[model samples]
Target chain A: MKRRSAIALVGLTLALAACDNMANQARRNPYELPYGSQENWPVMPLATAVARDEPLKPPSPPPVTMALLERGRQRFDINCSPCHGRLGEGDGMIVQRGFPRPPSYNIDRLRNVPSQHFYDVITHGYGIMYSYADRVEPTDRWAVAAYIRALQASASASLADVPPDKQKALQ
Target chain B: MAIFTPRANLFMNAALIGAVLLGACLLLAIRVVPVIGYNTQERFAPEQPIPFSHKHHVSGLGLDCRYCHTKVETSSSAGMPSTAICMTCHSQVWRNAAMLAPDRQSLAENIPLRWNRVYTLPDYVFFDHSIHIAKGVGCTECHGPIGDMDLTWKARTLYMSWCLSCHRDPAPHLRPRDQVTTPDWRRTPSTPSGEALMADYHVHTENLSDCGVCHR
Candidate 1:
């Protein structure tokens, strides 16, 4: 009986040792310094200078390509369509739900504004609109800005602007 | 001088031994069976504050998972939508419905709605939503027919052994990046086979089951 008890103890010890014990595990306390804090990351000193000194325009509108427009459409649908409406008519679902309605891109004021103004608004935010710099990368912001210009153009385009071949189809 | 014979004493001893063995079996069954049974349909189905049907939104209206859980690809948490998100549609459509009273109250009071979480892992298990999504694991593999659920329940038995089963062999569970949110998506002839996907996603099986993979 004593021998049996000794063997049982040995088995139990081995079993316990094999089990995963919570020891020496990394502990993240609530007050601990967070990973990827802004202060720890590399800073671009020129960003502020660029924002202040640069004219509110890209030298010219980006070369209009179908691929770029498609990418812009996708990005605009995800980020901008929530508040700006899918067609940029300032009647998004959020606006219908009583959030402040932004001016339509088709309006004279927005239509006349330089492309750089739109880029600035997207990067730094304008009035009630929050900055999307964190959510939208710089290239994507340009893409969205280009898409907004396309939307404005579409809203005001006349039948005369349609190609002769496409005009027949429209009729 | 004893009242009973040696034979009777032996019979009594045998009966006592049988009783002890039966008692031990009963104790073992009571302890082990319940733990296994707890992961089944009856035990893990928790009630929520509001009966928000995923079926209505996903299957009926054709809303994407990202429409509500917007941060699933970007953040660790697949974020719960705020009252404003719900109100964007609800305010126009079901403006006076009794079911949306809590939502309206939350909006009026300027307080966030407290949603009961389903599919929560223990604090010790470090799971990242972005990594799983980026690695090509579809939502349905773990979440299970979320588009069909009326009141969502814990679909999988989120036990460590169940997780390790996938970690050991995750190839069969992966799909194309575009179809990761598509609940009913399957391996079509046009799509690459599971082995090719495993190579494409670079899902190396080595060190996946290491204790620190989840525990740390």
Candidate 2:
């Protein structure tokens, strides 16, 4: 009788296994609401992360290279160009859609500001802008500041500024 | 002997054949039904609190995927755009659109807007978006022509076999990391060959197909 009961139990478990899905299990996932939290709003994960072995305050470093500029351009185009525009003209799509127009990088005051000023603004947003400290990294912020300088430079750069060989490509 | 008619042979044969045919039908049904049952809805767009158009936002405005899905390159979960992110434009553009009433309400109430999920994997699957992205897989490779999609739908069934097909040979799907979020990216002649990219991205296929890679 015990043997028969044991066989029946095994059969029951096998049948149950057919219904039990390993997929779509009931465990908590990322971005799901925290369990029984009182806050009505969506609780976001902490986004303040530093680069490996980096200091709390990363000053805009020097020895900027072509690679650094390229990285800066990519990160800037993704993060800043949405509102600041690709050319830093402050005429981004979001601005066209009606967000407050940010000052163009070509403005004299902005042109005069140090690269550190741009880095600080990105870390702690300027008026009407939210802090992008969560999105843009410390190193990338310097890259962006450098790219802004490049944009400002390009706005006024003559054919003489372009390398003679590559100048034909521009034409 | 009289009870056994000649027609009894025919009846017995018919019964045996019918039983075998029924079993075959059952087997076919078992194999076929669930595939259709589950995968049928995957292609169809589900109802959402807001009818957000990827075509309008992505294709029309030319916003980068990282503009909203900020954590795609860094985290496993491609983070959803918060209500504030929506308001960055809507607060100025469509401040009073009836369609955005839910968004307004959620923001005012300080409650989360429940966006319906489009691509929920089986809980056991530990798929990392960042890793695939770092390995040079473009958004279009998995998500399909997202820029063209008006309402998002699942492009592929996140089936194990489908995953293994890519994990076994990841080269064909790779792009330059710069073009990872580009919706219309196609490999040009200048683009490196798959073998070169496999070396470049450090993708070792030898253990990619192992069960523990995903199950754990």
Candidate 3:
């Protein structure tokens, strides 16, 4: 009889454990809200002609000023350099390890592409690029955009390549 | 006896006043301190998976935020960008520099940078970006003035209470659809109050404020 009581007590404990687990599962399920519920948002009127084609304005010219580049460089190091190499070589650490490689900016195809395309990609996040919308401000994204242009120019530049106005400014 | 009584009364009155004043101040700090809710600090300066900055891209170069973070209106997760995006330009730029350490590491190591999230909702909360964007919510409504910030900070407390306050009545925050992308788009003569718009949509405020609407 004593042995039977021990077995019954064990069964009761198992039943209680099962009950507790079910309760916890219910709580956990409640916390994870379902995805793709469309009806919750308030109705907003459709917007016509948002800036889809027009490219965002570029940043002010860099005089190769370290103070300016330092800010750009620091930000690049923190954000862009991780994916784009420090020299903007498209050899960013992420690329070498099996991630899709981005086109080199100096490539004729990319160089020929309008700057607006780049800006749109940065804002909206193209194939693999995530949106920096939450991470970087609008203007700062422009700054990085400008810095990127500068990096591209630096990589492909020759001493004879300086623009006439920039040559005089350097003198 | 009279002198003792007066002294005791003075001491008692002073102590009571001090206690009341202290309590009032504490209450005010909690209640009246300008739109501050709990978790404000965490939202204010969050650590991201990667240390990204807007100062360089926007302020320095005048780039729009939309250029990189595209899917604000269409997708749920404004999807984290992959390395291919960075290499698009980095390939031919800055070939050698100390600044490209992380980029280089990511390329060499074959590891993706793990970015920390800045704006996160409780697991129970359901937020749809497309609907909000479709209905004329601009990035700034929920994100605040990101164009102006050098460092990314949580501009608004995205708690259910905060969301409901706007949902039940969005008149104060509503602006024209054209002004959605304009970061500084303030409500003008042309703009309608959230109540007026809600009336147009026939949104019921009675159950609209229900917790399940946003919570689940």
Clashes of each: 1, 0, 60
- Model 3: CA > 4 A from native: A1-171, B1-18, B25-29, B32-39, B47-51, B58-66, B94-97, B159-161, B175-179, B184-207
Would you estimate the TM-scores of all the predictions? 0.62, 0.85, 0.47
Better of 1 and 2 by lDDT: 2
In candidate 2, what are the lDDT values of residues B1-216, reduced to their tens digit?
Answer: 599897999999999999999999898787776567365355777789999999999988888999888889888998888787786677777889999999999889867678888888877889889998899999999898889998998887777888999999898999888888998998899999888988998999999999999988
Residue A29's lDDT within candidate 3 is: 23
RMSD (Cα, Å) of model 3: 15.9
DockQ-derived CAPRI band for the predicted complex in model 1: incorrect
* Candidates sorted by lDDT, best first: 2, 1, 3
Question: Which of the two candidates, 1 or 3, achieves a greater lDDT against the reference?
Answer: 1
Candidate 1: tens digits of C-alpha lDDT, residues B60-96: 6555677677768877777787676686567666789
- Which lDDT tens digits does candidate 3 get at residues B12-91? 99999999999999998877664554445434756654456665544544444444545555666555555544544454
- Cα deviation of B49, candidate 3, in Å: 5.9
Alpha carbon lDDT at A55, candidate 3: 42
Question: Fraction of reference contacts reproduced per prediction?
Answer: 0.03, 0.81, 0.00
Per residue, candidate 3 scores C-alpha lDDT tens digits across A1-171 of 999999999999988886642212323221133343434332333576544543465444334455655556545655666566778778766666445677777788777776556556767887766655545545555556667778888887876788877887656
For model 1, the superposed segments whose C-alpha errors exceed 4 Å read A1-171, B1-44
Tens-digit per-residue lDDT, A51-162, candidate 1: 4444574445568788778878867876677668899998876677566888899988988888778878877887767666545556667788889989988888899999
